[model samples]
Target: MAEQSTSAESTESRTVLSWSGGKDAAYALFELGTDDVTELLTTISENGRSSMHGVRQKLYEKQAESIGLPIRFVELPQECSNEEYESRMADVMAEYESLGIERVAFADLFLEEIREYRENQLAETNIDGYWPVWNRDTDEQIEAFLDAGFRATVVAVDGSLLDLAFAGRELDSAFLADLPENIDPCGENGEFHTFVWDGPIFDAPVSVETGEVVTREVGDGKFHYCDLW
Candidate 1:
């Protein structure tokens, strides 16, 4: 864990952005100014891969570099229980609170339950949660992301919702046009996950090459994720 130094209390709040190294997160930071942001916080698996998108640590580092922010990665066990997840996250929040950080921003869109859960959790520590891309239409958001000059690739897809071939596919008009009606255009339902490699917010585009696809089963759900190196 990375520690932040304590500073004098101020009327203005100190904030951190929850980064997932994905298009949504990248877009959120761009849409929301970063002048008061403390750091980019993210969660990674025990093996140093992004817990959600499965992007490797090296690629994540490149993303942070391109976005020009210091990232703090919270490590989670390979097979952690929900209880452990909450405990670990609580500890991280407590640490940030001690440093005078008062809020964390997320990139959730049209997910009331998720936003509510995050707010509830943060309320426990007197910290607030901000959702920059909340309540937006998925189709419009995806189109805006592309029009903003961001480039991303589908890194993971829910095995039950999409074919394995969806992994490693560029996130563009063709990809969105090919998605089934049941799938959300912005992947807000977790039908798929993406890795943003370039965008207006990035100082430089991240260089990556697709690698072998790997599958993992969690509970009854399976995910097919492609590696990038």
Candidate 2:
């Protein structure tokens, strides 16, 4: 964890971060500096799990407690359509606008279409979009994350890109060294997703135990998800 300077900046705006309970989101929050961030926002499915990571709501609540930030969960029905998702998110943004929040941050690395979509969504409301770590080299970002003492575990893996064995491993140098050349070091291309347990942004480590790894079939592909509790 990097030591934060007590000096105040005059240009800081109240920002809310899109939290996925994953490494990139944690690292983005760390990069954004928590002083200006007002809350962490996550989308939860009807099954009580995070949207894509499949993390339990209870674990995310624990994460928020350890990170010393309030969190807001946007509930979505199973197999929500894009229009419905947008409408719900617009409502959330309106609520944030009412609270005087000026920006919403995301952890997008180099996904141009994703960023564009986020920006377009925010454009409809008074709040603007913020990207703390954007267009940076994925390899450097991953190295910097580890070098800064951020510890995370791989909790979800795209079975098509990686083996099931990679689902529950820690995100460390050894893991990086073993990754195939096509895989992004930071998993920026969705090769995998991680749960950050300890880092500079956290007041303390989130205590969790890895459970069973299960393979689930989604539309056309299979995903390996490691249960964490």
Candidate 3:
């Protein structure tokens, strides 16, 4: 079995990484040594087996396997509004509290409001939010992560700035430098989302091919996703 965390010698102060089944979560887990982390898991919305982030749940389970981490289940219904989302989060934190969890790690690249929101939410639950890659410039950080042997593919994107051609394409330095100015190279602003295929943090690379590009519309914008498998 993989070793637990070293966050506290007491074995009670367990720290968890919030898995998004994306590059940020993978990157954060990469930063933390397995032994230094009590457990790595994800919180997902499972209404209709669809994730709140619009990904598949089983995909996250597969991802957890790749990282050799176990994921705890947190499911919610679909199309949850802000109030509903907060309620769902509170319930999840309640479970965490029951598990004696005190620290949780997040993989947010660079966002002020999101970070602040996480901090505020965790504060109410007596849990501390740890942002491993907070405030770092997204481009530099993405490049460094890639140079460190991290590999990724464009799993999803905003249709306006990107297209299906980017899906499942290897996220290398060349790809980073060549990204169109319209899209955030780091995808910090939700211009795109990526799934890591290889990294120093992985036991092996995940082989996949682009399937299709689907778009999810929200207001005047749309979230474009490259189906990969």
Candidate 4:
């Protein structure tokens, strides 16, 4: 395992990363600049699948083990309203507060609405919010992520915006070069989502295999997800 910085260890406030098992989140953890990470926080479906990425629970466990951190999976039903989601998250934040974690970090990049929502949600709570990669240029951000020796694969792609073939591709220079002009280099616009398998923050690589490419309708659009196992 990589040794943590002294500054991170000496801090008083316990912290947690809002882990999404994606490239941006992985890169945020790498640049976390603090060694006091208590746990990873993620949302999962009632059936135990990752809420957005749709990755299996076992893989998430493997990821946590590789990162040497326990994960808190907030379970919710497949379909939920914003109110229900917020209520469940508030409960989880209460638990974190009881555990003495006063801060939570995210990897959000230049999304005003998302940042506003997050900040507003936490405004009334003891636990504060952090955005590690707030407004950096998407191209530079992704190049830095790759240059830092992180390896990830595209696991989900918006079928409306991206070709199905883009799914399961590694997040490397070649892949970035191939992205359409409309897609964000860091996929900040939800054009794609990734799963990090190896990185500076991990003790070892998580082995995974790509499964079938399946399309599913979400709201008014359809998405093609490359399942990983």
Candidate 5:
């Protein structure tokens, strides 16, 4: 983890973004601007998939490359406990703090508990947490993402809240319009997750094709994940 830092000091305060390889993370990066964010950090399972969005490590590496930023990956065991997760994250945060990173950024919107958790974690370190897209209206943010010519695909969906068919669909106005009123347009409530491929910030589009949708049962809930390659 210590080897991940190659960051040099700049006049402006530097921040590391907690990237999930999803639309919200991409939009947050856009909102925060590329100049301030020094690096992108993501947690991955032993299987080489992101912990939250299940994006492949290779694919996300491409995203970071296209965005012209260095990325750090924290690999965890398949069945990691919360205690282990926090312990590992704390070490990473401490490392960043030692490297003079003043802040860490998240893409949380309107989730009080989530924000509180992040705040509590950062309270233990010298670094502060930054939320560029916090408390904003999801509808407007989604509209802004589309208006900015960003393109993404729905890579995963909560089967309990959305149909499995939505897993492989492109994220566009039609998809949002078709979503039930109960679901947040930006999927802030974990109703769905997206993989951004093309956008204004990216140097080139990540060429990908949706392969198959596989349902996985975790605890009492089901998640439909679409494979991209």
Candidate 6:
């Protein structure tokens, strides 16, 4: 019995995934591991509130259970600016410092400025940024993320760059192939936003209904989003 148990435990894989309510991070985690990777999903929740990127804290709790992974949450405020963002990140890092987190990962793909920012930031800390999906052609990247058995919808779009109709549609090859040439296929320039569904990274898919397609004129441009519930 001891030998059998030891063998089973030996075969178990482990890793931690950075959580965001989006497809890029979901796909990165999918490629990294699928079965019980450390059981810990980490994310920064809204300050004083227990949610990540508008995801309910309880929902995340259920998600971790469904994936058979444990969860760790850090909270931050909704109106956080760049300085505040860094301070909160420092706090999270301090708590996990002794645990020897070999690397940290993100949902980024092919945005030079964002990548540079993350890399430079991590250079100041013990943890280093690991970009799993970087520099791939937009079509190929989107196709791969889709073909990897993951699903996602456009949760938001910058109205100035995209039509409001794009706010709540499934991300499939056809939609991607048909994207207007002027819009960045990956939305790297903030053309669109996504929420993930069934994928290799999830033991069970996240269930959400598109709530509302809202268009608001803010500053110099109008933005659109699909309220997800």
- Largest TM-score belongs to which candidate? 5
Model 3 ranges with Cα > 4 A deviation = 1-13, 45-54
For every model shown, the clashing-pair count is 0, 0, 4, 0, 0, 3
lDDT of 4 at 205: 97
TM-score, predicted candidate 1 vs. hidden true structure:
0.92
Task: Encode model 2's per-residue lDDT on 1-229: one tens digit a residue.
Answer: 1011112223345888888888889989988888778888888888888767888988988888888777888888879899989888888787677778888899999999999999888887888898899998998899889998999989999999999999999999999999999999988888999999999998999999999999998669988999999
Compose the digit string of candidate 6's lDDT tens values, residues 97-155: 44555566766777788889877877866776777777778777777877788888787
Task: Report model 4's TM-score to 2 decimal places.
Answer: 0.92
For residue 59, model 2's alpha carbon misses the true position, in angstroms, by 0.9
TM-score of 5: 0.95
Question: CA lDDT, every prediction?
Answer: 0.84, 0.85, 0.68, 0.83, 0.87, 0.64
Top candidate (lDDT): 5
Clashes of 6: 3
What TM-score does prediction 2 earn?
A: 0.93
Worst 10 residues of 6 by lDDT: 1-10
lDDT of 3 at 13: 34
The segments of candidate 2 whose C-alpha lies over 4 angstroms from its true place after superposition are: 1-13
* Tens digit of per-residue lDDT, candidate 4, span 162-194: 999999899899999999898999888899999
Residue 149 error for model 4, in Å? 0.7
The TM-scores, one per candidate, come to 0.92, 0.93, 0.84, 0.92, 0.95, 0.80
Ranked candidates (TM-score, high to low)? 5, 2, 4, 1, 3, 6
Q: Model 3 over residues 1-229: C-alpha lDDT tens digits?
A: 1111213335543788876766777778878766556666554554423342455555655665676666665555555577876776687677668778878899887788898988988877878899888878877787778778777777766667777566556777777767897666778887767777677766767655667676678568776666666
Model 3 — TM-score against the truth? Answer: 0.84
Worst 10 residues of 2 by lDDT: 1-10
The deviation in Å at residue 163 for candidate 2 is 0.6
Candidate 5 clash pair list: none
| Model 6 root mean square deviation, Cα atoms | 6.7
Residue 82's lDDT within candidate 3 is 78
User: How does candidate 6 score on lDDT?
Assistant: 0.64
